[model samples]
Target: MDDDALRAWSVSVRYPGQPEPALADVSLSIGPQALTVALGPSGCGKTTLLNVLAGFVPPSQGRVTLAGAPITGPGADRAVVFQHDALLPWLDVRDNVAFALELQGVGRRERHARAEALLAEVGLAHAARQPVWTLSGGMRQRVGIARALASPSRALLMDEPFGALDAFTREQMQTLLLEVWRHSGRRIFLITHDIEEALFLATELVLMSPGPGRIVERIEPGFSRRWLAGEPVRALKSDPAFIALREHLLDTLARHRQANDKETA
Candidate 1:
């Protein structure tokens, strides 16, 4: 892991002909070994901010940088995991995980070895030869995550990565992601609408509001460290403190929505 910090400086984005910016003056830092989650409702620029961080969409104003280098476009240094698993149907699990390495001209044996190790890390070693269509939704996401890790990326950027999974499966994936984060110690920036999930997974949580999306609040919830320190997931989530914080965040989001609606009206 490179431990390079990813940063956004007064970033803003506006689609052509759009009356307002999709993201306005959004600034944040994704430090090495920290899990930063962007939490917001639809059209709040969470995805837009993630895209800017991933270099998928260029900011109309301001800039994003990794270790002081400008993020002009997507690079292997920042791997992205989308809400949907975009695996190659024709390829088996191992090959799919190694696909990026192959593109980088890594030799077959080396890439395969690395892919197999990553599969084992994500608990998919047994499914190495299985085709993509054969895996369940959660299994497929594990493969996606394995693939992302196989990259030499300094940061992993995820956009609603668990949005497609059922509640139970999403929770399982969240636990698995935390384990991976603990083991890998790589920087992560994830966007999500799930309040509890954000609170549970984020070392730092950012709340955003729409109508030229801007951040409303930033919270540091230490639940992830507690989980890593051997606390059970269920217990952590059910803790009184956790419940109280969740309710507070929900109320905050509702208030923001009401204010935004009034301003637009």
Candidate 2:
């Protein structure tokens, strides 16, 4: 992975006729070694910020870049994994994972070989030949992640990728994701409303508030690093220090939410 960061500099977004900007002077840097999470309440512009970074939505002001080059539109350098799996129903798991490679004109044998390897890494090699529709929700997401890896992207931009899974599955996926990050060495930027998930997965967390959505706080939690260093996930999550920071983040979010509520009221 390139050491360059995916960056947003003073980015702001405004939809037509909307009195308030969706994001106001937002800035973020997703470094190569970071698992950055954007945590916020509803309407806090997390998704909008993601879109801008992904080149799906251009910022109304400021700029976004990777490796110092401006991002005018979506490129292969940044791959996105959405909340819901966007796999092709007609394709089996392996082909779905190879789809990105196929689009890039990779030969059949090569693409399949690469796809199979990724499937195995994600613990889905056995399901490679199965139809995507036959896979369970969590299984499908594993495939989604596998497909994202099929691209040559330097960073993965995920928007609530595990939100639809059950609690148990979500936790499992979180561990799986950490494993993937450790092995792939790819930067990850995720958006979520789940406090524990943010605390557990993020190397750096950006907390945002609504009413012209903007970042309220930035944190370096270090829990994901602890997990990478062979600490048990359960033990780390239950540690008093971890719990205390979790509570502090919760309080900060609540205070911001209350202020936003009063403003809108």
Candidate 3:
């Protein structure tokens, strides 16, 4: 299927008496099986935009559509992974993965089997029996991804999915995510504040400014997974291209702040 049309359009969100919309008329597209990352400063509506796509929050204006159809509510076809693992404390890793399936009334034996495969994919099979709270920070995120994968979703929406991990664990999680994406080839909408993280994993990079947030730019990183991944990205963590992207976003954020300042002045 051609996912060229998979995109966010004129999406705007405003909370009650917030002075301005949390998100402006923002729009962007995701190609099928192609990973798209939104890079921006904190409070730039990165997560809010992701929430709209996930149907957690409604947009004040405009619509979010996949292909030609409008998305009204959360469906089995779209699965989300938030920054926090958001796993059930009572359930073990495998059971957490199976929980989504259980809701659909899938029997225990089959869901457990599928959950095991996904856990292995994220390198958490060894910890499958462990309770969520007992796992390390990184382990919980892995289980989150595993649970998302277990669903039959055509698209994955991740909001800073590894922001909470330690440096070492974060790198490992990044590698694991790329491997999973390579195998799954599901369309992804990921939101992150880290420029390197966005450039490293995304086929396309989107930069957004603060509230009322709007996409300021979108650029393809134009590098391959084999060359621009794992340690290599860390090595180029401060490379000029990365630096340029960072500065560009910072500049936009600064401008927004200045405008707000002037409004107050």
Clashes of each: 0, 0, 0
Question: In candidate 1, which residue pairs get closer than 3 Å at backbone N, Cα or C atoms, i.e. clash?
Answer: none
Cα lDDT of model 2 by residue, 170-265, tens digit:
999999999999988899999999999999999999999988999999999999999989999999999998999899998998898788779889
lDDT of 3 at 15: 85
RMSD of each: 1.8, 1.5, 2.4
RMSD value for candidate 2? 1.5
Which regions in candidate 3 have their CA more than 4 angstroms from the true location?
A: 1-4, 224-231, 235-240
The better-scoring model by TM-score among 1 and 2 is 2
Ordered by lDDT, highest first, the candidates read: 2, 1, 3
Position 19, candidate 1: lDDT: 93
Q: Count residue pairs with overlapping backbones in model 3.
A: 0
Question: Highest TM-score, which number?
Answer: 2
Higher-scoring candidate on TM-score, 1 or 3: 1
In order of appearance, the predictions have TM-scores of: 0.97, 0.98, 0.89
What tens digits encode model 3's per-residue C-alpha lDDT throughout 101-181?
Answer: 998899999999989998999988798888788988888888888889888888899989989877788878877887888
Looking at model 2, residue 164 earns an lDDT score of: 96
The alpha-carbon lDDT assigned to residue 13 of candidate 3 equals 95
